[model samples]
Target: MNVEFINPFLVSLVNVISTMATMDLKPGKPQLKNHDIAKGDVSGLIGMVGPKTKGSLSITFEAPLILEIMHKMLGEKPSSINEEITDLVGEITNMVTGGAKNLLSDKGYDFDMATPVVVSGKNHTISHKSKGKKILMPFSHEHGMAFIEICFEDI
Candidate 1:
């Protein structure tokens, strides 16, 4: 896979998360996870398909991070992960993926992206069909941790 193809995804992650959560993020070296990634506390999934291959983009975080993010996004403290909070999570991923898509298109790479699907609770995995690469970027806020992972199959 081309390194150029990967950079925009990372850039979009940093930009969206930072803008929405008011936290700074950096492009750390992409690393692979050991086994299948179960949904931690919150997860946002968006599918992408192009001529060469098809895959999905997901961002996952634990409860602390999700709570803080929900608070920041809504400008108030959320008592729990209810429907309102769930809506916010899906919207956040939608914004992040949209940002990435725009950036990627600017660089002449275009594809169709599905609407974000948000899943909560636990014990679920973002299953991939092919042997894929996992790129993890960790972000921190005063309250908690939020990370972005780009998992995609190579064409």
Candidate 2:
């Protein structure tokens, strides 16, 4: 994957999360992960396609961290990952992906994104069927940690 494509995701994550969830986010340095699966307790994933590129956008949360974010969004503590909580994860993934897509449009990376899908369980894993590598960007909130992973390939 080209490094030039990275900043859009970082910018979108910080801006969207701050405004929507009212939480401050600190991103750790992004690291390349060449693995078959990404492990997470809860995940929201979106697939993107362009004339020359194909990729997937994924956001995964720690069990408790996702609940905290849902509580903030709902203004009440959420006890479990129900339909509503799962829906919020999809919305967040959409917003993050939309923000990045708009930003990248100027660079001629205009792409179409699939509807986000949410998955939850104990250390569930997501596998990306890409021809390139994955970049894991870990973020820290006052509450806990989560990760945004992008795996893209030239098509």
Best by TM-score: 2
Q: Judge candidate 2 at residue 20 and give its lDDT.
A: 71
Per-residue lDDT of candidate 2, residues 37-109 (tens digit): 5566789999998888889989988767778877766688778777877888898899999998988898888
In candidate 1, position 113 carries an lDDT of 86
Looking at model 1, which ten-residue stretch has the lowest summed lDDT?
122-131
Off by over 4 Å in 2: 36-38
Q: What's the true lDDT of residue 149 in model 2?
A: 92
Highest lDDT: give the candidate number.
2
Clashes (backbone N, CA, C under 3 Å), per candidate, total: 0, 0
What's the CA error at residue 112 for candidate 2, in Å? 0.4
